[model samples]
Target chain A: MSPRPETAAGPAQGRPRVKRFARAEHRVHRATAALMAVCVATAACLYLPFLAQLVGRRALMVTLHEWSGILLPVPLLLGLASRALRADLTRLNRFGPHDRRWLRSVLRRRGGRPAGKFNAGQKLYAAWLAGAVLVMTGTGLLMWFTHLAPLVWRTGATFVHDWLALSLLIVIGGHIWMAYRDPESRAGLRTGSVDAAWARREHPLWTPEDGKGGRGEEE
Target chain B: MTKDENPARPAGHDDDRRGTPVGRRVVLGMLAAGAAGVAAAPYLQRAYDETLGAAAQNDPTGLSGLLPAGGGFRYYSVTGSVPDKDEHSYRLTVDGLVRHRASYRLADLRALPQTRLVRDVQCVTGWRVPHTAFEGVRLATLLDAAGVRPEAKAVRFTCFDGAYSESLTLEQARRHDVLIALRMQDRPLGHDHGGPVRLYVAPMYFYKSAKWLSGITVTDHVQPGYWEQLGYDVDAWVGRSNGRDDVPTT
Candidate 1:
């Protein structure tokens, strides 16, 4: 048989096509996730020990937390430089009509609607995390550069930063649990690819496309 | 006030009570050790200050402020060591842009009517010592005695440590709460606590109250303090500067 054409078309006339996340998208996702994990872990280490004085290691921990928060945006900023990543960002920004249905279905313990590359829940999570990171960065900077803001602003920033930090912890926990329950979803993040059947089952609306996350040519 | 003419007696007096007869070599060794201890005390205190500050910094939660002010209070000196001054050597000079240039010894300051203020001592770094009683001659009295020049807009402070400096506008300097604090917590101010004389700007962050105060210079304009030069606010009203309003310490 002739060598299978290296295209999104198909392996043959009868074979099912396998769509996968683009390599760039996968790389950006993994890098962003890793950066976020580092930031969250550092923040946790610094804040979880409520009695830092008793621990007698507060200065080092604070410095670490400060630096990690300052650097949190770097990975995503770099990833946004990728055309593919930017497109993904746009997709994540818009919550579709199906998203509410998908959320309702998830709550009902049943699949409600087909999703694209990302479901409504995933999009909302990404959006929320992005917003949270922005808030954290703004408030953290205000706290770090003491003279940058007035006392009232600083006080407000501190209160908001602390509350948001706790909220992010909870949100991240739920996200991890969801990922844990779905091996294929985790595989998509890990290897940048998922089986066509898994993708179809989970995200029924996601279609194999030329440039978007979809079927790749047979190796 | 008794002059400490025999400074060496106190430095190594504890070591001398070991009960051995003073041999020639032992005497020389005792004198040498006393001199070294005196020289090293300030630096040793500075190290202790650094250790405490480091501990506070290491705490990410900033709960270290709740920790006992480490041996009653935090001790910090910009200069590693400052020479001790007794009554005879200590002089607080009020000069520069003043009509009446006055110099005060510790005795002269003590003779002046003392005003007591009980206010919270708040560090810009977030630690606070609450309701610290500081008794001293009113800075207003000293300024009135000096007759501040009409052109003077601010008061500049210089510390005996020769490094730390602070400033306040003439208006701020004259607030009733402000004092040339000579005593802290009912005791004569210890050297560790900016003894003999320290500016106590009760309403402002502690940094505004320059420690080891030696000179009060009336300047035509406000002068940025030691910490102010390094990004701290010139007017560090408690709960206002350093991007924190933990609570009004005062």
Candidate 2:
């Protein structure tokens, strides 16, 4: 294959492009990812025995983990200010007949329906992650400020926080794997745009007759 | 034959007043639960002990400290490593704002009028070991012997580990519950437990009961302890402070 285009900006020898995400959306995604990475890395150092021993700044690690977890939702909250992100979030929230067909097709390992800006799987993942992050933050706060709740509640919070964190790591791993398998999707996230032909093939419902993807473009 | 002879006795009096026996299913279920608990006991205990050990050494993940271990107590060392001090090498000094500054060897402390206090040891992080017996000379006794000057307002504690420090108001320091602890659980304190001498502030959070304790200095004012300096409440009275509602240990 010829060298892949670095960005979906200009048509490379006649390849048209469609904007998939606004700049504000991209910043929100990046900031959230960075904070999540910090939370996960610090959590590993704090929880895993070998890593804890090897790293050995227990108190500092505790502070970092707590702060990062607390800040994990800030970017998404701020992103609501961007009209483009808000519209996309609305789209991601609604499920149509096509999305149900898409889900059935994935389960059967066969092609069935065209996807919109986000597929059924993507919508489910987004919703699951949003709920997970909120729960994690809630439990994290309970654990951090032990005085806020009773001993039983605090104990339950710790248990939920730990198991939920493990689940989140696994789910995030799957997300990364899927992203790696789809370069167009990665490009859409990284450059805020994607090839029109690729969008038509993968998300035909989102690509209008003008070859411009709707909902995610800056208003 | 005995039943035949005692005809006046009620039939089934040996069984139950209602003449009903416990259900076999219920008994079996209870037996199974007990058996499962017995079978799982070792693993649970091992996990608890190992977690406590890991925390004591260095718990970077901070989560291990939150675990309610089997032993009721967990070790925590801020400096990661503290050199062991035995009776021969141990020395505790009472100085600062005092008319007669003095240093006591471990033997001298043990020879003094020893008072034993049994109370729950509470960590501000929320684990508690109930009814822990701490034996040593009362800190007030030392302050009295040292002849603390009228200018003294607080007592600052320094540890041999060279990193941890704690302070208490002079009034708090004089509480009968406060001790320059030498023994714990009726045995000589272990290195992991901050032996041969450690400060035990009975009513305060365990952090105020500084480990590897080496010095008691009468100071002009309260200087916050190690954890306090790191944002923990300076006056960490179990239920009264730290916004926690734990029942007062005292």
Alpha-carbon runs more than 4 Å astray in model 1: A1-17, A50-57, A107-111, A210-219, B1-250
What's the residue-level lDDT of B95 in candidate 1? 97
Per-residue lDDT tens digits for candidate 2, residues B61-129, read: 555543334234655656556788887888899999999999999999989999999998887765677
Clashing residue pairs in candidate 2 are A46-B60, A46-B61, A47-B61
lDDT for residue A96 in candidate 2, whole number 0-100 = 66
Q: How would you encode candidate 1's per-residue C-alpha lDDT over A88-159 as one tens digit per residue? A: 555555455566677788789986565766776777677667667766777788778877866655555655
Identify the candidate with maximal TM-score.
2
User: What is each candidate's DockQ, to 2 decimals?
Assistant: 0.01, 0.02
TM-scores for all predictions: 0.48, 0.62
lDDT of each: 0.69, 0.75
Residue B15 CA displacement from its true place in model 1, Å: 88
